[model samples]
Target: MSGPAPLPAPYALDDVDQALVHALQIAPRADWTRIGSVLGLDAVTVARRWNRLTEAGAAWISCHPAPVLAAAGQGLLAFVEVDCANGSLLDVARALAALPHVTAVEHVSGDGDLLVTVLAPDLVALTHWVTRGLGSMPGISATRTHLASTVYTEGSRWRLRALDRGQIARLADGEPARGEVPVFPLTDLDHDLIAVLSVDGRATYRALAESSGASPDTVRRRLGRLFAAGMLQTRCEVARPLSEWPVAVVYWGRVAAGALESVSRLVTGVREVRLCAGVTGRHNLLVVAWVKSLADAQRFEVRLNERAPGLEITDRAVVLWLMKVSGHLLDERGYRIGAVPFDVRAAARTAPTER
Candidate 1:
């Protein structure tokens, strides 16, 4: 008989690497020169280090539809709790991960064996996915879903605190627009550009143009328009086990309608809070965090109660295994092994939501 698959060795990040990743989190596509200035390293060194990390699949950059995309009346985002049959966890996870619309798949302990995020064009699509899509799939015995109503913060904005305030300021993303702004419709061209960036958000304009069948100038203008329109947001990502924050936790909580915004904002302010969104479930507020240890996870829970008394955390799930994040598939040690590119044009076949 064949032996069991070999376990992946964890890749540790030193201070410089952590700093570089943190800088990219601040400015996803910041030029090497600016990042170098912020990190006190030469531009070439910064670029070289990034290349090494990405080449090894230790880190990467990807783009996804911004909150404005949903606010503009696009797809619906829902959290799915999947109960897998015995011995079928791996099969079920791999099958779901291969789907286009299923964005994230995590095997956890608590209410369910897996937490799957799904993004569909409408209720019809979501229902079909839950019924036929998942019901018919082998190994999945049952599923529960929670609709996301307001996404106050996601993992894209989560960053490591390796840099000082001044250095962080030097690499921060552009100031977000104030108040409710007008929404813009996304074009086929915009979708094409997004598909390319979903694979490599830092892809050069020339490369994007070549792959997207547009002129370099056109690509640049369209990307700027997408950003200005709040239709697209990109972020740098790394293998969790490789970074300082390796443990992942999800908190299902509730917040009063009037206090939702305020409480969410307060909770998100916590450095460990990677995602805090309003949902239409028993527990309305869903928060996800990345911490350094299991103890830290417990500590975070205590800190959360102190920080946002209005928010009542119902259940918390520690990700025992994360099969996929955004579009990247991960190994046992959380290193990237592959990617299921983000493509909304494949709506008929699309998968889950952002982090």
Candidate 2:
């Protein structure tokens, strides 16, 4: 097989780019006018800049079923470690990166060749994919799956911490108020709505109606219900290599079950943490972070130790390369090249047949 393409030079982001990114992280679908007002820029200017960034693949927004939704039987989430045969790590990583259920894939410096995050509709679907689908792939030697018991924080919560509280308050004032809404079981129409929004979180209601074959009124009503139920969440993600913080770090740590809640809350409060969770495994807690450099990761660990006394960081890994993140497959330069919509319906169709 041919060798992989040469690594692209790192793309640099400017100060305005960073500010806009932080703003979007706070409100992924906020109107440009509101964002501009808070940032002291013209609405059109803000829109133009965002268009440029997205067109360059430097940033994007994605929609997914919230963790609460997953917990309510919408899906299953797990972290997987894959060991590959000698000299075949890249090939295996590339293959797994292309699979729809595999949301995030990274080549790391550690015991495993790759660390992957997967989402599936149910236990049977997860089992079939892990054993038959992934197991059948060539070049992979072994796999260890750790189911996430509680997702305290995910990429959606990670922010640049660049915007001040007042600025954030001003931006929030422009958005509509969200009140507590009753939870309901997801319908087939809801699934289709999620599939459409997963690709474009800011899709218009008319466009959503067209795609899902639902009336505009029905589409708007269902979407509000989903939001009220906390079943859907939108996130703004950037090309990490092009952002102000370029380095990615993952830590597997052990904490007492009693303290998991407090510890996770503390860790998630840290500005650098991108993902934090309580998982099932030797190490019950996992923390993922983004930093300006490798040294920053070391410094963050020291702070973590100080803040969460008695927590043991069992192992840490630096992400050397990210092949996929939240279903968006990135190129060498970290620009989005393709997307695999998070559609749980596929699980039913792909399930292994019983003998």
Candidate 3:
């Protein structure tokens, strides 16, 4: 089994740092000069703040589609808990951490286990990750998996924009003045597709063909490849909040020794718990769920306590506000496939001479 876990220590930042983070979250691509002008700071100051913020990892600036759009068929989110054998928790975590689909990894208290978040194209890929990728890791004794159904928040885009009627109208009219800073690598074709898709996921192939300057067949082939690769997915219109069931909660807990699978079966079988995992910390298990109201949240919690008496429920989070959520944000460091070769012929589409 894995040994002791490598818990990430909390890092602190001051007010200026916080402001810089907020600005980047709102507009990742804002020019230093423009940001400085808006914030009443000089360009140099803005640049310095940007550098410091990035260096500290307090925030990241990248571009990709929102979560809902990304998870259409190609991707899914899940939380995983691992109980290590020896005290080699970090070794196991490091191994699992390097897997292609793993995103966020944390070592929690209480149970002192490892918690991880992964994104995969489909259930088959997810299953392979759990059984082959993680289960094969040395020192790892146990694991629990939870599939994420709906995301309340992630990245920098929100499900519901906080705008007035006028602003909403402006947004709907394709005139949102605000810009987002995407940090993911983007190709000219990818950029063109994203630009169009942002306005309407259901836009016709001909329309996309026009905007992207590609033949209908080419566009179709590229989109097909992207979808197959788990990159450009999600074609549905934005969904309205589940008004009938608006409760969003994450529950973290752990099971008794030698009862991992039995408890995992019981927890995963619960319909109320949309996502459940065996995590590391005071609560070695984590579950995310959405219900109709606050009453539903409480009732689920009480039921969990009753069913898993030894399962320690440590911490819980009631999502109050989600500032941003998106799946299409591009990582600016490189293109989705690789470094897109520079082509002057395609410069117009890449930089867009007009805007």
Candidate 2 global TM-score? 0.90
- Which runs of model 1 end up more than 4 angstroms from their true locations? 1-11, 173-181, 345-355
Candidate 2, residues 281-353, lDDT tens digits: the string is 8999989988889999899899989988867999999998887888777776567776777676564355222
Task: Estimate the TM-score of every prediction.
Answer: 0.90, 0.90, 0.47
Please list the C-alpha lDDT of all candidates, in the order they appear.
0.81, 0.81, 0.49
What shift in Å separates residue 231 of candidate 1 from its native position after superposition? 1.6
Regions of model 2 farther than 4 Å from truth: 1-11, 176-179, 351-355
Cα lDDT of model 1 by residue, 1-355, tens digit: 1212322464477889999998888788778998998888999999999988887778888888877767767777889999989999888888888776677899998969999887776677787667667867878788889998989998788776788898887666443432344567777788788777877889999999998889999998888767767777788888887767899999999888999999998998998888888998688999999999999999989999999999888899999988888877777667677777676445454333221
The 10 consecutive residues of candidate 1 with the worst lDDT sum are: 1-10
Candidate 2, residue 128: the lDDT equals 78
Instruction: Write down the worst ten-residue block by lDDT for model 2.
Output: 1-10
Clashing pairs in 2: none
Displacement of the residue 41 alpha carbon in candidate 3, Å? 1.6
Question: Candidate 3: deviation at residue 242, Å?
Answer: 35
Worst 10 residues of 3 by lDDT: 333-342
